[model samples]
Target chain A: DAGITQSPRHKVTETGTPVTLRCHQTENHRYMYWYRQDPGHGLRLIHYSYGVKDTDKGEVSDGYSVSRSKTEDFLLTLESATSSQTSVYFCAISRSGTTNNEQFFGPGTRLTVL
Target chain B: DQQVKQNSPSLSVQEGRISILNCDYTNSMFDYFLWYKKYPAEGPTFLISISSIKDKNEDGRFTVFLNKSAKHLSLHIVPSQPGDSAVYFCAALRAQPSRTGANNLFFGTGTRLTVIP
Candidate 1:
């Protein structure tokens, strides 16, 4: 389980509204990531954080932003929701700093933008 | 372009049989590979992984075979059970100069495996 939890396991919102999904971890892992899983795309990284206040963009980072102000928490925000943005979002953590390091995933949050 | 690809979208197998899921990648820089299994409405869980240095890695009834020369990899599940009927994803990792040791992964589209009871 990786001591991970995601808020609003399911959500529905209209386009143009801002939404934030929170990922919390009980373990103090140094690396945290946010990814969106879609049918054809599989899982694409949206953003990741290496340490508190340090974050970077991922492959499909458009329209999304992330913040990790604390070690155990990483938040993913959609600046303006779009129907295309509707997908299951996943949060993962790794102890190491590398991108290919073994990762543990949270349950996931399904967001629907109408 | 998709760096990692799972050509098969779905595969069916009978209980107690063997199931093979194939994955291919285009990036020769990728040295580490991983497999993850996901049930509907849940997050993917790490299954097994193989480094480019080895051709095979085994844990219990699951094994991953890597063919670096062909830029291919396969996950084999022996004695497939109905419980093993889930989506399997193949991922590859290469360190980018931008992020020293950070291991961001490139994932395949995934294959849905169904083990008929």
Candidate 2:
């Protein structure tokens, strides 16, 4: 409800191919994040960008890369897809500089790598 | 190692009854804690949060309690409803802001709450 949108609501791709997911926000929040959700792991942070051209790895950053060239968009890319990477990906945004800044999430993108 | 942990994988509660969800964390420096609820096929939504400075924070039918000494927290929903059925995640954030720290969050495995009518 925070004006966040994720492209390719659902995607199916084969292994050994490249995949990219897009997250767009209209709220103009200063912070954006990419996360993957698994059955037992819940939602694990993959990467986050605090500002344009500034990004950092999260707990489960392996095999994932992110780019934020503009304020409204953040992209997550998998160089070579694997079945293990199949999961629901979520994009979240938050306004920085506040003690209780809350993160808002998009509907989510379900990716299936076979 | 998981800094934040939610032991229960799923919980079932009867409609109109109180639902209690539990979470634990090992980090002492985490000053802020939050709870997010996610429905099937959707992303998580912010539920409620509590700061380390306070022992309890309440909003509507949802209440969050933080126990810094025990490194634990819990969420209570009064008269739970079927709409409240969803997977809930407990998250913690370090208060300090540094170059290495980007206000990123550490999350738990999440607890699935099912309110049965």
For DockQ, the strongest prediction is: 1
CA lDDT scores, all candidates in order: 0.92, 0.91
* Model 1 pairs in collision: A97-B102, A98-B101, A98-B102, A98-B103, A99-B102, A99-B103, A99-B104, A100-B103
For model 2, which pairs clash? none
Q: Score chain B of each candidate by TM-score.
A: 0.96, 0.96
DockQ of 2: 0.63
Report the error of model 1 at residue A25, Å.
0.4
lDDT per residue for candidate 2 within A10-53, as digits (tens), equals 99999999999999999888889999988877778899998898
Backbone clashes for every candidate come to: 8, 0
lDDT value, residue A83 of candidate 2: 97
Interface Cα RMSD in Å, per prediction: 2.1, 1.9
Error of 1 at A73 (Å): 0.8
For residues B1-117, could you state the per-residue lDDT of candidate 2 as single tens digits? 888999999999999999999999998888999999988888899999998999999999999999899999999999899999999999988877547435677789999999999
Q: For residues B73-97, what per-residue lDDT tens digits would candidate 1 score against the true structure?
A: 9999998999999999999888452
